[model samples]
Target: MNKRLVVLLGMSLVSSAAFAQSSVTLYGIIDDGLTWTSNQGGKSAVQMQGSISQGNRWGLKGAEDLGGGTSAIFRLENGFNVNTGTLSQGGRLFGRLAYVGLSNDHYGTFTLGRQGEAVGDYIGALSANGTLPGGILFPHPGDLDNNGIDFRLNNAVKYVSPTIAGLTGVAMYSFGGVPGDFNKNSAKSFALQYVGGSLQLVGAYTSIDHPATAVPEGVWTPNNTVNGNYGLAASSYKVLALAAAYTIGSARFTADWTHTQFGGLDPTLGAKINGHVTFNIAELVASYMVTPTLQLGAAYSYTQGNVSATGKSPHYNEVDASVDYLLSRATDVYASATYMRAGGGAVADLAPVLSPSSSQNQLALRLGIRKRF
Candidate 1:
């Protein structure tokens, strides 16, 4: 009888252990906003913008406790347009993220699958563009810098080190998945960040080799010659960024600088097109909270691109401001506006209606609500 009792108790323990090893959760966010653009396609229009405050997404995340201070985790997230109920990120089911990895509190985590690049992860923290209307006006021209506007990569491997003395490091690589051209469309990036007290600092670099070829033929082509260098045969592009922020009480201030270059284009293409373009960006942002539910923020950015081809230089100055009201932990409303002016050769390439001379100006406004669950 005693033997039977021992066997039954052991079976019960095993069942409980199995149950504790696994768990799954569902999470999502829905955001929509009304936007007024001064010259979108040269026609003033009012439209609904999805994923304004945050990308509208639904995701499944799960973990299995593997014992010995380790866990197996995975995340599958999909982006969608709340305005039209269509898939975002070009219709991929898990366009935002799809990764599986092992984690331990002592070591860190290494994940494999689609993931975000270093520039998108590190420098994004210094800007408010990831939140609400900030992204609409503040994203780098064409979102070439990622910051917060661009999202994820495919076929990637990523590693994140445990924080040590307020410092952490991240690295990622994406496979091009092209036949006969192993390096084509591949990319890599790394970043290091330190957060201590009320100060934050970050530095990062990223390179992409032959990205344009990764797309289907006749779908899209790089219009800017500088981008062509990074898209064509045996070519690459690189970006370096440094950003810092300081916080005191309820107010925070941020400043950042970035330099980007494109190189290694086909010589024939380089001759017909600009071989290289060096660009610099500078930004300053400040935010304050009037109450637990109310906050105000403002930012300004300047960008200048030096032409290696010698026709003209492109420069832009933009200013942004917003006010946010938090109704609850998972819900908020905001009003925001931005004004931008382009000069030098910049306006020549803009929409004809908006660019009569080598200069252009624009204003945008948005009002929106968001909720997370």
Candidate 2:
């Protein structure tokens, strides 16, 4: 009996030590709002909205120590609508993000599963829609350049380098998953980011083959839940983006540019010829902290698109302004106004809900609250 008691105590100590090396956490955010739009398919509209500042999400994350400054990590995140209690991302349970990875303090991190591309991960926050002053309505026309967190890559593998001299690098690739065609639906992306004091710079590039087939539920799909049928089908899609941000006292300024191309358009897009369409977009944003709990911000952006076959150029100009007040460490309330004007025979469109306007201008306003846990 004495020997058995000693053995049981030893086993209990080992189990406790192992348990101490592993941890799991639950986290989430909720955002809801009321919105008014100047035009939607030629009519004005008002509605209750969810995910104004950010998407509503609940997630679980865990890490297990493996000694030698290395660990295994995993995450599962879900997006939902607070209004109707339905899951976002086509009703998938863990559609927002799901990944498993290994991390090393010195060697960096490697991950696999559905994940964001480099452009949206590295440079998105420096753009208008990714900033605090902007929200779903402030994304570039149709979010053609993916400056917003609108999509993710499936069957992906990603690597993030450790910060060196205030700089970090990221690379990712997605498998086509086709039985015989290895590159038919593949995607590749790369990004670099540098942070120095109050200044930061980032750049990223992404190329996808057969985007529609690669990510059927992605933003490229016609009439997606977020953007309209702006990018229905293409043989390939590519994006290049760069951004810089600087802070001075209580003020912050940001600038960014992106180039997007839809190559080898399908007949559904009305591209009668065998050429591609391209868009060049640029933006500037500034924000100031009025008080410890209050902030104000404004931004401007311009987009130019060229149709190689028709020789037609369509353009859009947009302006945005916003104010935010903090209620507590985990909650905030905000209001925003966004307007866009279209030219060259293009209709105006706002993001996340509103449809394309019949005329050349569209405006959107929203008041919302967000809480994090």
Ten-residue stretch with the least lDDT total in model 1: 348-357
Candidate 2 weakest lDDT stretch, 10 residues: 223-232
Instruction: Please identify model 2 stretches exceeding 4 Å from their true place.
Output: 1-7, 222-232, 268-273
Error of 2 at 101 (Å): 1.0
Candidate 2 structure quality by residue, lDDT tens digits, 1-373: 9999999999999889989999999999999988999999888999998876888999999999999999999999999999999999878899889999999999999999989898877777887787864587888887787777778888999999999999999999999988999998999999999999999999999999988878666556545311222344678999999999999999999999999988987666433445677889999999999998999999999999887766778889999999999999899999999999988767788775678877889998999999999
TM-score of 2: 0.95
Candidate that would win on TM-score: 2
What tens digits encode model 1's per-residue C-alpha lDDT throughout 177-254? 889988888888899999999999999998877644542221113443322222222256677998999999989898
